[model samples]
Target: MTTLTKNKVNDLIMSQIPSFGSFQTLREEGLAFLKEKGLPAMKEEEYKFTAISKKLEQSISDFSPAGKVVLNAETVKSHLFEGFDGDIIVFNNGHFDSELSSFQDQSYELNQLSESSPENLGKIAKIEKDPFVALNTAAFEDGIYIKVGRNKQVEKPIYLLFFNQANQGQIITPRILIEAEDNAEVTFLESSISLDEEAYFCNMVTEVKVAQNAHVHYNRLQHENKKAVTVNNFETDIHRDATFTSVVVSLEGDMLRNNLTLNLLDSGCEGNMYGLYLLDGKTHVDNHTNVDHTKPHAESNELYKGILADSSRAVFNGKIFVRQDAQKTNAFQQNNNILLSENATINTKPQLEIWADDVKCSHGCTTGQLDEEALFYLQARGIGKIQAKGLLLYAFAGEVLEHIANESFRKHIDALVQTRLGSSF
Candidate 1:
């Protein structure tokens, strides 16, 4: 085992002194875990493309509690949930804002991490291993803990909003944990927005646990400030016969990286993942996803598409793993990209590792520019070049957006994609 000096671990622990009072034990445990395992090196296959060491080298500071921000109801409605109905839970810089949050009867419980019970803490501690996860477990002051009871269906979705209004050169970490009990159905929309031009870092971790026979839909909409850096990690556990769907839409940020993992623990489980990224200027976005089939008869499907314009770049790495006992497993994955400029670049890799003999798995990825033949055909039919390109791009992205079961939400995302494509498109 790799070892870290005691003083080094203590010094790292000291950096979190401001937000380190309540969770001191958790912090020490995390420090010890890091000392034993050390940080993931560049040689680690999973972290090869993502150079997290540079990020960890930066000074670590405590994220002060941002009590609340004055936001007009109209502005909130306009920015989030333009065409959907849901219970809204707002967080300003990692702290829950009860004043701006609204909930229905007892369909769900919304509480802060600081107010969570010992039982919940035990659950969170069970999965805290990665350096970032350990860091979040060590220094997270306040966040949201949502639970949907058994046999209950949340008719309205739950919206978790994370807004960053930090000073320049500041960094914020928003940590959240959600649990859906057996036979429960729920939809969660998590958004990250910013209102300043600061170079802040929003390092967030969200852990979700889905009980047997439960259905859960989790969507992440990241539209942080153009000058900010955001790294989000989503980890999910799906039990017997459960279904979990995750969709991520990223539009703005300087450097953004998302790590998503779905673990199928029991038979007859289903997992779906979809992502859409639109980047321009000098923005860089990376999406790394993993799906693990641990039990027999599990199924998973994943599709990710990107539109890169200007001089932006995007990277996609998706992996599917089937254990030896996971017989009769079925998994499919595909990634496609469209480069709008000569300088734009896209790197995509779809991987499948199957140890079971009876599994059916297939994976493929394609990256290419817009079809000139199709563009010429449309232009020849009296369509303008800009309009023809826009139409083609819309059709290229339509397949993935069609997976959204909600009509209104689908239309909303469609419009957003069109608007982001700009007038020239």
Candidate 2:
């Protein structure tokens, strides 16, 4: 286990100066909590495979606090979605960029996080458990707030683009809050891009609340510089008869870690999660998801897949909890991984804890290489070796890709996947 001295952690916390609203209480509390309980060490079972202390130490040691970054509109123009006609909210170096943001109508309200009330801001998710989230709550300077009014069903999707232009040895923490009221429906898309080839750290946290009968579809795309380290945490609360769906895709980054938590707070709530990761080089990706069933008749389903090559490493840990009162709950979880290189490593675990005797729950995990017989079958039909391998991997990944509802975005992701698999030929 790696433990940092109080002086060192205090120095790290004092490195950044917040320009947003007064958050000294959160900062002080977070610093105290961090001092008492340092970063997750190797001995910690929850973070055994993807320990963060060493990497975090290095990143923090190299941290250089930066002033507000001035970005030209044309410089980030290429990062926008090609065919999506929905609203676009852009964040430049963790700060909301009003000039780059656009919305379709007044069906929803968009504001800066600093303008929101503290009760409304931090009530959705608890951050005391994770030091990363506590640090984010302490240090976040600016963020976005989105709220869909009651009975508002937005036809177009809402896009959130987080563009990072950090210099070497800098860290950016971006925060987001979303609330979907009763009977409201909306689709949200989140994508991150590292503009330069600077080695930096990006920490992000998003909190969502879905009211009764509300529906929300959320997709997060991570395509950053290979030298950058990104950590994202998502916390959501689903109310009665509400539904929440999340899809996460990680394509490029030095190290990526995601912590997703869903709370089925009321009866008839539904939660669904899906993920796809394609990693190569020395990249590392970790995904940890937790779903809590607190009421009866709630349902949750989770599926995650990974393809690792070269010396890449990946980890997936999913947990489902059914309380005693959560009778009639149904939950399912699965994880699948494909390791293309002998040096690549994957650790996956699907866990289910059911206290209610009247509930149905199941979990499974699998890790294996691509089927050689399938490759041989394709090669026998005059296909080249590389082409056959690409075909098989493509088919394996297509099962998840085909579930994407956005045709244009799905095609874009498909092309990227093909390029990664060398199937574009």
Candidate 3:
């Protein structure tokens, strides 16, 4: 791990200036924007519910991260899919580790960021908009660059693994870009693994470009130790006759936030979003998302659910926007939460803003505890309380897991869900 104080993060960026390559101008722009805006404040509407800035300052007086943690291939292998066949890309502390990774397929081509330039690099996820995005743009030393060939379909799903381990603390920024040419089909999964007992922070950004007649599916799994803090920003552009789907599952973390943006740019395009978070202890997870439909005959759907126990907290704020020309658009969004204990809390808001009269849009949110009547019915049948509760919670979470298209991956994720709930219930 690379140790650097938060105060000297800029120095790290400057030191790597020579290796930035085609992203040099973007780094410069990001540096300028960060200088002007600085980090987000609690008073900001977006960060009002999360006091991450304060948490950072309090955790480290100088806001600097130091320390080191190590892991070899054996440890990483243990975390991989058991008896599963797929391509794996490993990232250690936010940088690519080619020696520990393998990609054996002709359906796609890979290039280093310094040697390649994606045409729509900074357009879909503009650094000018978010401070964290700007920081990642300026500080990221290396990341993944993949281009799927036209009309080609990947036989196996690709997995991206991010590992973080620090004794004291460390800040990691990483970037990813995926370009699916016309008529291509692909599925990608992302996982964040935390090893060690120290504090660490990760700010990651991913951008996806789906050309006409192309299909892309991306799923994320975050189950890290309580000392890890995470901020993930995801953006995608859907063109005409294209499709995109993003599913995120959050099981554990100290403080985690997700900012997702989807843009349906042309007619006959579709997008789907699904998320589930189960937490206990003092853990907190927040999600903010936006979907914009700019053309007629476009559709979008979103669903987010959470189960909180103890003093854990969860937040959801989602918006669906339909432009004036986006007539005949079909949009739906919903957020639901279950608080197992009286101390648990949730704040949820789902909204729809439409400038078109002929569009069909709906949004709503709900927060409550497990159904007492259902629980009693199971107990009346001679089932134990813990078993009944597990059955009920698992049923509620199953809705989101059903959206996973890959059967093997879906079953793997289901096992994880069951194990997590089994221990808590």
User: Residue-wise lDDT of candidate 2 within 1-425, one digit each (tens)?
Assistant: 24743456556666764644556666667666766776677688878898666676665554344445777777666766568778888888888889877786789998886776435565655667577777677667777788999999888888888888777667788889999999999998888887788777887888999999999999878889888788888999999999999988888898888999999999999999999999998889999999999999999999898899999999999999999999999999999988898999999889998889998898998899989998898899999999898988888788777756566677778888899999322
- Estimate the lDDT of model 3: 0.84
Report every candidate's CA lDDT.
0.76, 0.82, 0.84
Clashing pairs in 2: none
lDDT of 1 by residue, 178-235 (tens): 8889999998777787866766666688888899999999877777777777777788
TM-score of each: 0.89, 0.95, 0.94
Worst 10 residues of 3 by lDDT: 60-69
For candidate 1, the lDDT comes to 0.76
TM-score of 2: 0.95
List candidate 2 stretches off by more than 4 Å. 15-22, 62-66, 423-425
Candidate 1 residues lying further than 4 Å off, grouped into runs, are 1-13, 18-22, 33-44, 51-75, 118-129
Give the candidate number with the greatest lDDT. Answer: 3
